[model samples]
Target: MSAAGQTTVPFTVPSFAGEVSDAVVKVLDSGWVTTGPQTAAFEQDFADFLGAAHVVAVASCTTALELCLRAMDLPPGSAVLTPSLTFCGAINAILHAGHRPVLVDIDEDTLVPSPETVAAAAARTRPAAMVVQNQGGYPVDVAALTEAAGLDRTRVVEDAAHGPGAARDGAPVGSSSYAACFSFYATKNMPIGEGGAVATSDPDFADRVRAMRLHGMSKDSWKRYLPGGSWRYDVKSIGLKANMTDIQASIGRAQLAALPGWQRTRGELVARYDAALADLPGLVLPQRDLAGVQHAWHLYQVRVPDRDALIAELEAAGVATSVHFIPASHMTSYRAVLGEEECGRVPVTDRVAEELLSLPLYPGLSPDGQDRVVTALTGALRARS
Candidate 1:
């Protein structure tokens, strides 16, 4: 509620307290503010959290995906499989990495590509690499998908931007994938305002990414400036200016520490949404429970018959909503770059694009605010009915 007597609900909110501010302040005060102790500590802490072997922080998830793809050293113009019902950035990264995007269809239930879809795409293109994303924090079984893919284990990169600490069958996300890329963006599970990281199993691959993230240089600013350290470093290979700064990593460390509690809160809120909307006619809720799978709960999306009308009604009532993504096929660049035939068959992705609506969900969203969202939702549904 505000002074104008309007009740409001934001689509998402970042949870940042004094610890985040203090962490940034401490980083700014330190003479070494660029990739240094704080950034290194955050990478180690994240690796420990996911039980991953080697972790390297980067500027964003897009570049993380690009770097991981480039690390595979796929032959030029080789196809890279990814979900069509995903953020266009994933497809763009594949293109930017000098690979062709062979968009695959997603399962309607999970909103993530199924093993069947992976198998089908694999047979179609015999891709050199694939990006298996945990869309909306719903885990995609990498092992099953890889087996179905019939590709080498190292060819797959898990887009874990939504599910960094999320687990499946007792193993956390980064544990199983060849390479899992994580995001610490403003609205992500572990909010760092802006940054990302890649966790891989192979030490050699990790070393490649570490050097590649900083212009393929042998030594970073931290290593070069250490006492008796040489400023004379060698350039190893081609890389990107995609290094995560200490300031962002400092905030990310705080968010990572509070991750478990925040995740529980997200699950609780989703439960409330599930219970409240269960009886509402013509409303299709997201798949919430799967045995041995713990969701990241980054999104609480529902499929309504008239998405646009409901969005309007909610907006008028001071409630906000969002669409997870527009299908890649619908995007201008994807169509121009891949053509219709190259994008491949995607009936489910095309259909779901029109119906999906994401509601307000975040650790900072209060119970009363949730209730307000529900009330506004019910009223809108009733009117549409």
Candidate 2:
């Protein structure tokens, strides 16, 4: 339990100190800050890090997701199966790209859409694609989900917003299957202030994403500066402005350097939290499947009976908390498409939405700070009984 009335502790903010500043300094010194050399290098380096065939850096994860959907060129009204337990960006992307997002349920323990639910949804909708999220950094069983959807017709797009160094069965998150999106958002495992990337094994898909990320211009800004580079360029396709800048890429490059050490520290913290909160009644600990994958530990989310009450209690004790989602179908915009009664049919998502709460867990979090969170949560849940 949190020690009596201790409300203040060391404030831990996500940082970009180490090599981040130095890298950014280089970008500043270079003068040309827009999508240029650093951005190209970052894309190549990120691809290498994930062992992916190609990687495209973009302004944000939303852009990455949107661009992927747009590049795929799905038919109007085509259903794209996605988890209800994800950020709205993926859902919005599906909608913006001329498809309907068929929201699905997530497994209670994993917080990711289960193979069973995905199979059921696919069977019903025969979706154009399945946008599976590595919910809260816990790698979804890609093989299982892929198998569930069956080979032909439906493609899988991994929304790995919380995954950068994440893995499944010893393979990096973006390397395993279809197009995988990674966020280098301010709060992600690797901070790029606000940016993202999409990696894939498919060469054609990668090319399409690359083209779309920069107004569908066949040649990028870098290529235009080459020795024999032509001045005139054609608009290959009507595309959006979603390219990543050299400045952001410089930050991403630096963060990539520090990623391994930070991931190791995250593992240690998860272990400590797991041990500290182990036998608390009514508190469902976040589950981990260490069989093949290495968790990125983006946000340590758990289920509790009175989650809102628990969050209040923890906040009063000086702990910050967040909820991963509030089912997209339940939101006003989506609700118009999927009414209350229809949305409630996704039983697992509907029920778990009330129970899910994310605890404070990040690289900067100190052992003492973590202890405080554990004590606060355990005591809060215990008090209810």
Give the least accurate 10-residue stretch of model 2, judged by summed lDDT: 2-11
In order of appearance, the predictions have TM-scores of 0.97, 0.94
Off by over 4 Å in 2: 1-12, 151-154
The C-alpha RMSD of each candidate to the native structure, in angstroms, is 1.6, 2.3
* lDDT by residue (tens digit), candidate 2, 131-159: 88988888888778877877342277888
Candidate 1 lDDT, 1-385, residue by residue in tens: 4334686788888887558888888888887789999999999999999988889999999999999998888999988889888887788889988999888888888898888888888887778888998988887889888788788889999999898657899899997567999988898988888899999888889999999999999999899998999999998788999999998889888888898888889989999998899988779999857998888888887899888988888888878889988989888878988887865488888888899999999999999989989998998787767
lDDT score of residue 55 within candidate 1: 90
Report every candidate's CA lDDT: 0.87, 0.82
Candidate 2 residue pairs in backbone clash? none
Task: Tell me the number of clashing residue pairs for each predicted model.
Answer: 0, 0
